[model samples]
Target: MSLSLFDEPKLDSHCHVLDPARFPYAPDVAYRPAGQEQGTLAQYLQVMDAYGIRQSLLVGPNSGYGLDNRCLLDALQQHPDRFRGIAVVRNDTPREELQRLREAGVVGVAFNATLLGTEFYANTDPLLRHLADLDMFVQVQVEHDQLVALRPLLERNGARILIDHCGRPAPGGGLDQPGFQALLALARTGRTAVKLSGYQKFSTQPPPHADAQVFVRALLDAFTLDACFWASDWPFLKAPHRLDMGPLIRQVEQLLPDPADRARLWWETPRRWLGF
Candidate 1:
């Protein structure tokens, strides 16, 4: 408990680099992250430096770039050692492209059933299986009971699963909520992990995020400290209100008061997962 986490070397498991000025948003994309939602690499690095974050796992945001991962790839290529990425690829993406992305420092691909809906990804089994074959993670973001239908697809072909934002459970949904339960059941797969980050995304309360504490505890019990990692979801795209990285970091302290648990959650696990 004496640890000063502010200086701890940690890996941000979920974040994005949106440099629209240099990278440009996809014209056909449905949404563009203007204003505070957009974060250039320079700004993010400043935040990272402030927090002593040694590295980050950047996810391609579906908002600004859609299926275009150029922005994500550029950041990875520019700082290969400091960043690894999860790209957003079409379900029909070719194996060669996946390989190319892998070589460029993409360890995985993201599926946003939370935004695009479950039916949009109904026939993604082949892609999912291929990603599994490639040893790349299938990072998923789903809410409510959306995970129930996709659980089987994740299980198929022994895919490496990484659930985002603590499954973004419905407020007051309780620990037994089917989607959250399904997320917990995924722990037995061994190939699965969860990011114990982004309470602001799902929590009904402000900072302390009291309602999410029980779920975080359950995840620690089920997925254990190793498979459950930390993320800031920095720049906090599409956030409902104002957010800041410094406060979220302190919130982790409140959630995992044990310094040992904080050490593992913030540093050891993500470093191991990303092979840093």
Candidate 2:
């Protein structure tokens, strides 16, 4: 396999893996992945090896498993050096359980406000504080508009915040949009890190995602390189078109051609944030 040419160790900061045959979807699964081929841990490792990715953050497929983290925990246990996890957990989940997840190599907990609503946070404030106390990252997946309102609340309760999918910015909003601007401001605080990921999820244009570059540049200018991270959002779940990991990796290189910038985006930032 041809390894990455970049100087620093690479990490895909966001990806999900699941095998429905072994770990079936929750009864109330919000949505099922459209693809016939679900991502498996073994499959992800094959790609990681080919691309020279030294580590990865395996985010729980929340829609598939609900609050159950067995799939993600298993991956971490089997390959502790190569993987860390972000699990989906409920408000009432006990402290002992959270500690168990931490021992199992889960470094963060994810909440999908787009599906769960803001009240989810209201109910989970205690859990959020517990996560913060444990020094674990709090991952929030919400649309651009939610940032303005959510930022203050998160600042007060969350230890560190990871905004998923580039804040799910609206097309053509660019830097002027209040929500996007708020997201950039949050990044300026250094406590909030934005995943330079899920381009296909937010872009109006197709892959290689040229349209999203303008906003990304603005984020780099505002957030600084250390607060930004790059990820594959692999298996391309729910994306409009199929995307291969090779092109996605190349896209970051094209976006940040300077070796130093590429190293930060692909390695340093994620390594620090995810504790890899």
Candidate 3:
């Protein structure tokens, strides 16, 4: 379809929703947002509608709720057409449980290296096998530097590897950072896909996050258009300030001047990578 930002039916490859009442937040969660009226599914959908985002992938918010995926799964099941989910499960989680998740519209499993540790990533044989059996990707949220150390292991395993938040390079480090360089090399292999998202997560500057382009451009230059996905990281929970969706959407369009590139970023790549 030939379209611009206002008309294109897009897919937000990453976002979150939390309902503390239905699914209690884990006490051991690393951090908690102060407000209860944070991003809920209904609020996120409103943003999606405003942006013409036809579909979204609800990433399991492990930070606030540990491994509990009920909140994410419920949204997936309740709104199958508009959303899919990535669940957070321990390496030892039962196969039957995974099978159930698959049936419930969970397209992948997420690993938070920032919290789960290198050991969790190191022991991937079983997890990879299970994910392969389910035809799902392994989504990793890791420090940019870890991309170098994690590359060989992720590549050796043969399952699809999705890197979160533009490989999360040091703010302004761009291609010079060793980890980002490793990420670029990984992209060339075609087994890896990086999310064009979380601008707020890694940016040191204020709103609009224009400086993040140094990394964004490097990703588009290194990876095939189909290997890069776009996301809102909606609700922007950890950000220093709340963000509006319009500017980010415009930023993506500006970064990808050609409609073909925007198509891949907004829909094609995420569709292929997430089984949408």
Which numbered prediction scores highest in lDDT against the true structure?
A: 1
| Tens digits of lDDT, candidate 2, 166-194 | 88888777678877877877865667888
Separate clash counts for every candidate: 0, 0, 0
Please, what is the whole-model Cα lDDT of each candidate in the order they appear? 0.88, 0.81, 0.81
lDDT of 3: 0.81
lDDT of 3 by residue, 1-276 (tens): 565576687899888897776677888888764574267777787888888899998899876877889889889878998888889998877668888898999888888876666666777677877776777778988775877777777777677778889988888676788988888888766668899898877888877777888888888888868798888887777677667778888887778888877888898888877776
User: Which runs of model 1 end up more than 4 angstroms from their true locations?
Assistant: 1-3
Better of 1 and 3 by TM-score: 1
Q: 1-276, model 1: which lDDT tens digit per residue?
A: 454678877789999999899988999888899988889999999999999788999999999999899899889988999999999998999889888889899999999998899888889888887897788899999998899989988897677899999998888999999999999999999889999877877788887688888888899899999899899998888777688888888888787788778889888988787767
Clashing pairs in 1: none
Ranking by lDDT: 1, 2, 3
- Each model's Cα RMSD: 1.5, 2.2, 2.1
Q: Of the candidates shown, which would achieve the greatest TM-score relative to the real structure?
A: 1
Candidate 3 TM-score to native: 0.92
Judging by TM-score, tell me the better candidate of 2 and 3.
Answer: 2
